[model samples]
Target chain A: MPLAKRIIPCLDIKNGTTVKGINFVELRDAGDPVELAAAYSKQGADELTFLDITATHEGRKTFVQLVERIAAHINIPFTVGGGIHELRDVERLLVAGADKISINSAALRHPELITEIADHFGSQVCVVAIDAREDDNDWHCYLNGGRIPTAHKLFDWAHEAQERGAGEILFTSMNHDGVKQGYALSALRHLHEQLNIPIIASGGAGTKNHFVEAFEQGMADAALAASVFHFGEIPIPELKSYLCEQGIPIRKL
Target chain B: MNIVILKYNAGNIRSVDHALRRLGVEATITDDHDLIRQADKVIFPGVGEAKYTIEYLRNHGLDKLLLELTNPVLGICLGMQLMCSHSEEGDADLLGIFDQKVKKFQSPSTDFKIPHMGWNTLTDTKSPLFEGISDNEFTYFVHSYYVPVCEHTIATTDYIHPFSAALHKDNYYATQFHPEKSAGVGERILKNFLAL
Candidate 1:
């Protein structure tokens, strides 16, 4: 059997608590990050991702403490993002038991950081997340939590990241995010064709069928969603069962 | 039982420590030769490039110390690769406990990624390390290089092809997958190792 398609639940954390909001606004408290991580692991999530939305200096300290707690409680591997500025931050998170570290703006600003991370740690430890939106029939990469648009094209930047030794690419379509529609299939498929590393499809995962589409059509190695898994709209076990029935290779508990 | 995780310059060693803690066993992370030698079980866990790590091991004399230990020793991911005869990653020669050569995954096509990240099933299980685990049970794997099936292979997992997922030779056991991060199945595997 081929490698099972991964189902990852993303926790947008702020001040040590998990939060979910529509389009990154009107935030609502979900629960404690550690408790949610433990529950998701029990539900057989292939991996858990905690993105520190605030990324404040104080929040970074608390986030590190939170990572330690999640590592102590959860047995599955996890990736942590947000406010990872340098090698020291990556080292700290890994030391706190994070299996992988994702970087976005910092990586875009300093492409050398990707090579540094992959060289110091390993390519498997570096995950480059790209937030891009389709503009004039071409996707343009965004930065600073999708507020500032960059001149880097989606495909070109993703390719560069892969060349720079990124293990995986987490591509989130800003247009599809928070819409509950579906992933950016064309872009994801394009990435799958252009890059050799695993591509994680993020944004616009409404139903379980959307996930199936992401895998079958988008060719995504993993599908990441924040609200659908957090709001109890779709339980991970049921989703996995549905994906399995769809002839998708999934890890069934 | 005293569990010492042979710690050199490597990533994700703490995650192994945390996993053992979840199993109610606190493993000490150290490079101390005496502590590792005295432990009932030694876990050689790592996630880094083999070339530099193997060099560090040799410089610290861990390469020879590891060979001398008679206790049950478990190697994870890069630790497993370093136990092989040689690695294609850096063309570096490693400890010859398994006699298998590690080779980088040549993606036959884009369908198979290099890292082989995500969960996959384990088959041909023969070791007590998988005592409570059944065949075709899923485990987490994240690595670019793999040891092909060999005489020492106790378990096999298929990605691009059948490769050595777990190896067993006397007191030394190694797994290409991260059993520490494989959820309940991994926890059971660790418990089985402790029972050994």
Candidate 2:
């Protein structure tokens, strides 16, 4: 049976190492991407997502070496994002052994690229990574690590993405990023209500209960976080047990 | 010897590549047909709907290519389903290499969800695939459709009905569960598959 719910672990890689902090600050090295990914795979993570937060800033694709290393070690489905803007980026990521390529800025600037990726790679292999912010008025979408704002409404962009044949949506709320407050439930719900494919809810993970709430309140198919899992604040297996005790559907190791 | 994983427009190739490496069996991932054909063993895995996947193969004309392979092939989850005769999901047509039909598990009878996610036990173990593995051992699963029990039923698991958990025919074998994501037992299964 297909997984009804997913618990994903995110590793923000900068300078070939995993880093995590609020608003992308106090950047601390977690560990090697391959080592951390292998550990997570052993712990029964349903899937893994890698954000190359420094790839663009570094002006090169850092994923080829890291992704190849991880793929040579960790055996599970994983995604790669950050600095992905063209077919070459997708090609390089795929060549490095990424199961899926996620587009955010590129998807917004040239929506046709979404179709091109979908048409070439199939919708399942192309996931649109959307970073959003709630400005006390209406939800607005952001790209390039929340630097560029898209004029398209959050729900509107999600709908366009689905129409363009995106297999999944990796949504991170800028307002919630690193806050560990919780996922932006309203925006998540808005995207969920609009799209049929799976939605991986990222950012704002403070506690184990946040994962539960991401499912119960946000109705997200998956909940993703970096610090909680990296710091051992919430061991995934124990969290799964608690979720099981709560009757939440989770993939057992 | 290194096992080559054909990385086309499919799903979950990296995990398989990583699993082999963890088992100390060097694995290479590539879409080049020659490398796949030359591999000691081949694995075709997928996570999307079978029809579109089949269409993708048909579009690329790789369906016939996959069916022609003679090496020990292990298909996982969607990869396993695509090797079957047909699929109920999306009314998809499969490669039909295995004499079985992949049918969607309809909970029209009880409260069991359509896509059975999580761990379940495997029984009726027949093939060497479970050589080091135990009976009634649970593995990870994530799918809405499943292959029904047939002559190829090397193992069985009950969701609402006893369904085929694993299948075997000649050198081609498959599992509805993901060995890559199944922890150490999964690694052992991959090792077992490699040994064949």
Cα lDDT of model 2 by residue, A1-253, tens digit: 3234788888878877777632321223336677667677777787788888774545344557888887667666678887887888887887787867788998999899888887776676788988888777677888777898877777888888988888788898888888888888877776666666668899899888888888877888778888888778888888889887777777666
Any runs in candidate 1 off by more than 4 Å, and if so which? A21-30
Tell me the whole-model lDDT of each prediction, alpha carbons only: 0.91, 0.77
Winning candidate number (lDDT): 1
Q: Worst 10-residue stretch by lDDT in candidate 1 chain A? A: A21-30
Model 2 residue B173 lDDT?
91
Per-residue alpha-carbon lDDT of candidate 1 for residues A80-183, written as tens digits (9 for 90 to 100): 99998899999899888898999999999999999999988889989999999998899999999899999999999999999999999999999999999999
Which pairs of residues clash in candidate 2, taking residues 3 or more apart in a chain or in different chains?
Answer: A1-B116, A1-B142, A1-B143, A2-B142, A2-B143
Docking class of 2: acceptable
lDDT of 2 by residue, B74-144 (tens): 88888889999888877877888897878867664313533465466778898888997777666767666
Off by over 4 Å in 2: A1-4, A21-30, A55-59, B1-15, B26-72, B77-79, B86-95, B102-127, B131-151, B154-165
What is the lDDT for A155 in model 1? 97
What TM-score would you report for chain A in candidate 1? 0.95
Error of 1 at B94 (Å): 0.8
Provide a comma-separated list of chain B TM-scores, one per candidate: 0.98, 0.94
